[model samples]
Structures are given as structure tokens and as C-alpha cells.
Target: MPEVTPQQHALFEEQGHVVIGPILPPADVARLRQAFEAQAAAWAAEIDTPLDDYLAVVSQWTNVWEHNPVFREQLYHQRAAAIAAELIGCQRVRVFHDHLIVKPPHGGSTVPWHRDLPNWPVAEPRAVSCWLALDDVTAESGAMRFMPGGHREPVTRSIDFLNEAKVWGERERDAVPVAVPAGSAVFHHCLSWHTSPPNSTAGWRRAYITIYLDATCTYDPTRAAWHPMAGRVSVPAGATFNEDVFPTLGPGLSAAHLATLRGGAA
Candidate 1:
């Protein structure tokens, strides 16, 4: 597994977010892209709305691993999981969920500034999201802008992405846009204030994000009672997330255990 450098660790601790990678090889990036296309096509066929219209309004697909084998394998990506654990300073980390967000060229809307922990159902704020770029991303192509050290702020209510702005009174000038090549990733804290502008370029902007929480994080329905993944949790409130659904990942997590999680996908 890959490791975060001392400097990278320090930066993440101070800034609430840090870009790392190409953690994935070109081959892995290509495979993920192919899987995305396949999943998109499947979605298009099932929806009554035109694919373009759907892309414009609902460009995100959650827990894609359940429907796609490629993503199922990627769900256990050791490098990403290891880095997440290291950054969180947790002995183990477990999946909260994964989603693919695509910003169609000149079509997608701006994602308003917000902190993720406020929207999650987990009890603690100890979590990190691995945002993997599936396409070369730039400021004009919908790359995320993050407020440095924003995670230090107290957790609050979730933002209305369609209407709210200045969630924490963060100044736009202080925020920094982060762009990366395909296969690279950005690891960000759960409470980091971040947002992305609409894609202005002709090329699509795609990102696959896997959120990992400290294994000790427990369910807290009061945080986000209507979270999509809430229904998937078998445990009661204040209990650790069900390991069957959110498999743990770390040094002692063996390949056989991951294979068990993969089942047929393995």
C-alpha cells in the first residue's frame, strides 16, 4: 500500500484537505472510466428522462459498487483506504459509501459550498473522502475549491446546495481551487468547506469519491435521518456501522477478508 509523506500528512492536518496521487495507475483509471460509461448507459436505458436531461439534473450515482463489478473491486482499493486511515490517525477505517459525480460540459450547475460531516449520519467528524479524478480536471472543468483550515470550524447544519451560500462566511478569495490529472485524488476532511463551480470546458468532469470513517464512528440518525445510506445500516443508533456493509480496511485487514467482501466480484 502507498503511504502519505510527512509533509502531506502535515498539510492535510492543517488545511483540511490535500491532493495525493496519481495513486492509481493509468490502467486502473481506464478501467474505471469504462465502468462509468457502462453504468451511465444502464441508467439511461432505465430512466424515462433523456440521458442528457438526467445528466444535467442528476449527475451523481451512489454506491455504484453494488451494480458494477469494477467499482466493487475499487471499493477495497488498499492505497486509498490506507491513506484515509493514516490521515484520520485511526487504527482502521470503514466505507461510509461511494458515489460518482459527473459534471457534463457546459451543463452542470455549481455545487454550493458545504461541509460533508453536517450531512452525514455518523456520530463523529473523523472521516475523509477520497475524490478520484476520472478525467483531467481543472478550475474551468469543475474542480473543487476548498477553504483552508475550514475543518476546525464547529459542525453545523447541512447547506441547501441549490440556494444557500457562504455557509461559514468563507471568503471566496481565501478558497483555493484544486485540479489534478486523471487517476490522481484529493483527500479531504469530512468538515472541510468545499464547493465546485459548473464545468465550463467541453470535456466532462468526473470524480469517484469514496468516504471512509473511523471504524469507531457510530450511527447517529439525528445527524442525517434521511441519508441515503442510512437504510443500509443494520445497527441501531449509537452502534458501530455494520461491518458487513461497511468493511474495515487497514494493516491487519487481510486480502482474504476483502475477497470475502467481494464475493463473486473477487
Candidate 2:
């Protein structure tokens, strides 16, 4: 992850989302691509996922860190975790979840505009996602479109990702297309409003996204329990999430904590 400067921080504060370019080295990007492909090959058939189009939403393995060594390493990668912590202004961050969203070439399903927070169990606004591109993404190739500064707006309900007819009210004009190269990432506040179009190009659009929450984040029982993580989190409502599941990724995390993370990856 590239360093987030004061200016970049300010931009993120204002826009609710910021695109950081070419963060991973070329080699790392290539390695990640291979890892993602391997993960796809290993699990694509095992998982009984149904798709209307050539799209996999929240696809592949949800806890990819526990399944693949490469993804596991990157999930807790210091620079990426550091960037996540800095962006959220938290000393420590916990893994909310990870995703391997694969949009195959031509006729990929459309992802409608919506905020990520309303879809999750976390309550506080200190969570963010690091979306790492595995393939070159363009606007035509289903790159996510974001509404700048959308996080500052009121909490909006999550909508159907396939429905595009719903109006955005007055915020439609501020939407911007985010196109980034492989090895680059788009860091967006969890509440930031975003969506992506169908992949019309010849290449596939794959992204590995890891959501990080403030270490102190706890469950909000009021939210819907659609996500599998909500079931895995052992702590009761309002309790700090269990460390074994959401390991701390930051400076001075105890060896016990690191051991927990290692055991998870192993």
C-alpha cells in the first residue's frame, strides 16, 4: 500500500473514497493474480453458487485468508493493514471479511449503487475496505463507480445490486468512474456509495477486497444477519469481536495475537 499523505487523507475525508494507484509491485500483483486464479480453480466447482450471468458476487471463498497462503499473507500484510488503519484513524484494525469478486468477460451482472455499511453487522463508521484489482479495470470493464463524499451523507439502505432503475435522488451527478491498473487499489469508506457496471470488454474483472474494522468495533444486533461472519463472531451483541476470528493487524499486537493469526492462515 502506498503512503496516505495529509492531502490524500483530506481528500478521503471529503470524498468518502479515494483511489490509490499501483500500490502492489508488479511482481506482487502477478503473484496475487495467480493466487486468485488458483483459488478460483480450487473452489469454483466445490461451491454450489448459482449465477444468472457470468458474475460471482462475494464469490470464491469469503475467508480467503484461511484458504490460500498468498491471500492469507496479503490479508495481514503490514503495509496494506497500515494503510487501512491510517485511513480509519485507528491504532488497530480487525478483519471484517474478504471477497474474491470475479466478473467474467461479457455479460457480467450489473452491481447497483449502495453503501457497504448497511449490508453489514458493524455499527460504527470506522470500517473501510481495501479493494485490490487483479485485472486491469476500466469503466467499460465493470470498474466500480463511486459517489464522491457520499459517506458524509445520511445512512442509506442497501439496494438490490442488479437494479439500476432506482433513482439516486440529488447525488447522481457527483458519481465518478474509478479505473485502476492491476496491483493498484481503491480504498473506500465502508459507507461510501458505489456500484459497478457489467463487464462488456473481453477481459475478466476480478478484485480481492478485504474489509477492516476498528479494533474496538462491536456487533449491532439490530442489523440483519445476512453475512456468515455474524454467525462466526462468538461475542454477544455489543461485545468486542473475538480476537481469534478478527485478529489485530497493527504495531505491538501480542505474540498470542500473532499466533492466532498464524494459526488461522496455517
Candidate 3:
């Protein structure tokens, strides 16, 4: 599994986000992309909205790991989890959730500018998310833009993506648009300010995001009624997230399996 260098850790703290590889090899990337497309098509077929209305918002299928083996493999990949632990500065990382976000060509809706932690059920800010692109992403293709060092500020209220400017009324022109090729991933702090614009390109913008939380994250009852994770665990408020749902990876990996993952060279 890959580990973060001191320099990368510094970058994350300074900017609130960092760009990582074509983290998966070409074959793995291709397989994951296919899985996401399959899931997206299945979801789009079930939507009854007009194309115009649908394009006004991005599509999100959460906890996709429960449904697809390919997604599950990618979501719990050793390298990816290791990266999350490094960026989050946590001893152990737990699965918060995973989602596939699709932006249809030419008219996908804009994702409103907002901070993630405010909308989640977790009480702490030690969560990180990896947004893996499945298509060639451009600024006009609804690529995510971030406000560098924005996570240092207090959490702000969630925004209505389709109607808002930047979080707290900042200019849209100020956010930094992060464009990367397919297979590249961006890691962002839960409090980082981010949003994506409408897709003006000719192809769909596909993304698979896996979020990891501090292993010791506890449920916040205040947001439980609406937060998705509320129903996924059996623990009470202030209790650690259960192991069955959010497995720890670094110390959890079996010795034999860990060796294989490291190409028998660990």
C-alpha cells in the first residue's frame, strides 16, 4: 500500500486538498470506469424527470459498494485507504460512504458550492474523500473547483448547488478549478469549499468518490434523521462507528493478503 510522504502531508494541510495519481493501473481504471457507467445508465433509466430538469443537477448513487463487486474492490483498495489515512492524519480510517457522480454532457447541473462536513453526521473534521475521474474532465465538464485553505474557516451552511455562488457569497471566479485526466484522483478535507459547474462538453463526466472518516468517529444524533449513515450503524450517539459497516484497513489487512497487495515485496 502507498504511504504519504512528509511533503504531501504538508501540501494537504496548506491547501486543504491534493491531487494523486492515475492511482490505479490502466486495467483497473478501465474496469472501474465500466462499472460506474453501468451503474449510471441503470440509474438514469429510472429517473422520470425531463432532460432539462435532470441536467440541472448531478446524479449521485450513494453506498454503491454494497451493490457492485467492481466498485467494492476499488473502494477498499489498499493503496487508496492508505492514502486516506495519510491525508486525514488518522491512525485508522473508516468507510464513511461511496458515491458515483455523473454529469451528463452539455447540460449537467452545477453542484452548489458548499463544505461537506456541515452536511454529514460526523462530529469531527477528520474525514477525507477521493474523487476519481472516469472520463477526461475539463473545467467546463463540471470538474470540481476548490478554495485553497478554505477548510481553516468554521463550517458554513450547505448551499443549494443549482442556485448558489461560492460558499458564504464568495465570487465564483475565485474558486480554483481542478481538472485532471481519467484515473486521476483528488483528495479533499471534509471542510474544503468545493463545487462543479455545468457540463458544456460533448461527453459525460463520470466520477467515483470514496469517503473515509477517522476510525473513532462517532454518530452525531443531531443530524441522524437526515444523514444517510444514521441507519447503517447500530451504535448510539457518541459511540464509535461499528466495525462491520466501516472496516479498518491498514491494521486490518491479513498478513498474507497484505503481502499479495504489495506484490509479495512488502
Best by lDDT: 1
Candidate 3 lDDT by residue in tens digits, 83-195: 88767655678988888888777866767778888777787888999998888788889889998888898877666556766634555556789997888888899999888
TM-score of 1: 0.91
Instruction: Output the better candidate (2/3) by TM-score.
Output: 2
lDDT by residue (21-82, candidate 1, tens digit) is: 99899999999999998788788878776767767778898989888999989988988998
Minimum summed lDDT over a 10-residue window in model 2 is located at 50-59
Model 3 stretches with alpha carbons more than 4 Å out: 41-58, 160-173, 252-266
The TM-score between candidate 3 and the true structure equals 0.84
- Name the candidate, 1 or 3, with the larger lDDT value: 1
Residue 166's lDDT in candidate 3: 61
- Pick the TM-score winner: 1
What lDDT score is found at residue 114 in candidate 2?
79
Clashes of 3: 2
Better of 1 and 2 by lDDT: 1
Better of 2 and 3 by lDDT: 2
